[model samples]
Target: MYINGAWEPAESGATFAVTNPATGEKLADVPDGGRAETVRAIDAAHAAFRGWAGLTAYQRSEFLYRAWTLMLERKEHLAQTMTREQGKPIRAARNEVQYGADFLLWYAEEAKRVYGETIPAPRGDQRFIVLRQPVGVVGAVTPWNYPVSMLTRKIAPALAAGCTIVLKPAEATPMCAIEMFKVLHDAGIPKGVVNLVTANDPAPIGEEFLSNRKIRKLTFTGSTEVGKMFARGAADQMKRVSLELGGHAPFLVFDDADPVHAAKGAAMVKMLNTGQACISPNRMFVQRSVVEPFLDELVSRVTRMRAGNGMEDGVAVGPLVDDGAIEKVDRQVKDAVAKGAKLLCGGHRLMDNGLDRGTFYAPTVLADVRPDMLIYREETFGPVAPVIAFDKEEEALEMANDTHYGLASYVYTQNLARGMRIFEGLDFGIVGINDINPTAAAAPFGGSKQSGLGREGGHEGIGEYLETKLGGFSV
Candidate 1:
């Protein structure tokens, strides 16, 4: 890890091994970063901010644009790393790298537009301009899923806004990000401007940056419970926090919607990251009049998908992150079955081609899933989706909003009225109407309720890196 222009081992001299969730095979070793390393990172960022912030917008933007181009040139290599570490299909991992670079490209252009506006004063002799100044050093904590995109969502915008960063990526998927940090250095981001650390135990590492007064802002992406705990910890020191927390997103298919299209679209999301994504559609609420048809279509589409290794092309479902994820989802499935849900397809472990030794779980489908079931209430984070039916729009809306999570919601309907109504009523940070693809580098992404606080992406992303300053001047 690089801290203050030097790569060093952890003060504790402890290291953790990075393993492929697909096979539980060792990929590489990284530092077991803790408070000492985190403090060093913060100190480096604190020292670097002035020179980085003082650079002209055009100059800074030029460097960022260079970074964007570099990312595109090596997209495939980065995607392979993502697949190996996080267990997402290579096709999806490719998209993650592309989208992650898109953030850099967007913010490269946005850098020049980080503007300050002059205010009208009652006295002609007095003048004022509200400046959006950088909020000093920042501490970022990102999850294993979408490893590259999530990291870039915070890093790109913060760089555009002129804040130095200390990134603590999840140990499970650290190689891609560590490589990207090196890419930044090659792209002309000065030493000490961005530092990265990875470890199995991030509590202590994050605490260092979180507790430090020099680190003025924080950004995180992960589970709601952990995000809440960290945010509370940051609050103790009055640090600014931006979190992209967990979700159990609702997929609502109206009776008026085309069953085939809805099924195809919903299945696409369910298989995304093996359904490990936070904004991924976990709960399916179909109109009762069309429930049977939707379920039939869903089963058909999913049954057609080829499940295998991520590196294997034309495969939709990949292995879970590890045996733990497989066991957790398996247990959730068993609980749903015990709770009276019917197993539509796929309800057991793999038993072939060395797959049994790996973390592979077959894609599953559950019918008649109740709201009270753990699969319905908790995040599965694997390839399994349950179908629930509702007779009325009100009932569907109530069911959609039932969970504490309000990250992202999906709606498939031909009726614009219904889509707009659902958009307004479904309490979430973002809404995907008739589309499974809810992410874009240009749009703000995050969540509501316990999902998260603040937002990431577009100009709103840059906002998190800034603190408003009102200068008092008289002429």
Candidate 2:
């Protein structure tokens, strides 16, 4: 763990092992963060916010630019670390590095672009001004999947908004954040502006941090349940919160949708991070006319994708990050099958015979999924996708919005008007029309309902870490 601009172990002198989910091998040990250490990080961030948030936007942007350059210099190594810890394909891991670095650069430039306003007052000797100011220190919690990008998503925007951050990265993938801190330190970011801790028991650690008044804003990307807990804790101190949580996104394939091409693209995005992605398509609703053809092509495409070590070339799917994830996927498949869903292709674990020795699962395809099945309603944060068919667009949309989640949804249609209609009607914060992937660093990415709150990315992301102040002066 790195806190207060210094790299240090947990104050308790305890460590947690970092396992390579690709091979089920222990990679390295990271510090086990707890309440005491969490408070240290909080205190450091609290002390630093006064100076850090007060810096000119230009200065903040310049420092972030240097950090961005530093990130570029270490992209490959960081990507490898992410792959080793996260179990995503090396290519995908590298792409995350590039995209994460791009966010850093984007937010770096955006840092200097935030402007306050001068407003006219109706009364004589009264001048009004509006100011966007940092929301003091922030407590950020990120997930394991796409570790680098998730960390960057929080760090880039918060830093750009002139807030000092004390972040807790998932224990499953800690090295990526450690590497990020190294980049910041190498880039000469002032001490205490960024803090990190890796802990298996993050809730207590986070609880300790949220109890502090100086940590005024909270941002998290993880399970909806966890996000809710964090929100409640932050609320105790009246801390503002921005959460990007769970999703059971529907990938609707209309009759007008091209099965062959749509399958290819949808599969790519759906199976991302082994389908552990919060925004990954889980409940797929294909039109009755296209369901059979889509499944046929989709099954073939998934079969062709080589499942192996993330570091290897030509690998399409990799491990599930840990034994727990693999076991969870296996249990879900069994449960779904017992409940009546038919397995079309894969539904079992892929032993690490040649693809390394971690936790790997086959890319599973399920059909005849009913509304009663748990997998139909729960998040299949694995490579198991249930292909559900619908006849009417209304029914498709209804099934799409059935879950408590509303993070991301996909609608594919050849008719421009129909596609746009479905896109606008989606009950999601993010809608992908004729596209399986929609998130970009340039736009706001969030969800409605249980999916979470606020936004991350673009202008909205920066504002999440800031407070608006209206001031008046008598002229």
Each model's lDDT comes to: 0.87, 0.86
lDDT of 2 by residue, 19-122 (tens): 88777678898989888887888888888888888888898899889988988889899989988888889889888998898889889988987889998789
lDDT of prediction 1: 0.87
As for candidate 1, its clashing pairs are none
Model 1, stretches more than 4 Å misplaced? 11-13
Q: Give the best candidate by lDDT.
A: 1
Q: After superposition, how far is residue 247 of candidate 1 from its true place, in Å?
A: 0.4
User: What residue runs in model 2 are displaced by over 4 Å at the alpha carbon?
Assistant: none
**Local error of candidate 2 at 9, Å?**
2.0
Q: In candidate 2, list every pair of residues with a backbone clash.
A: 23-357, 23-358, 24-357, 24-358, 125-475
Candidate 1, residue 445: CA error in Å?
Answer: 0.5
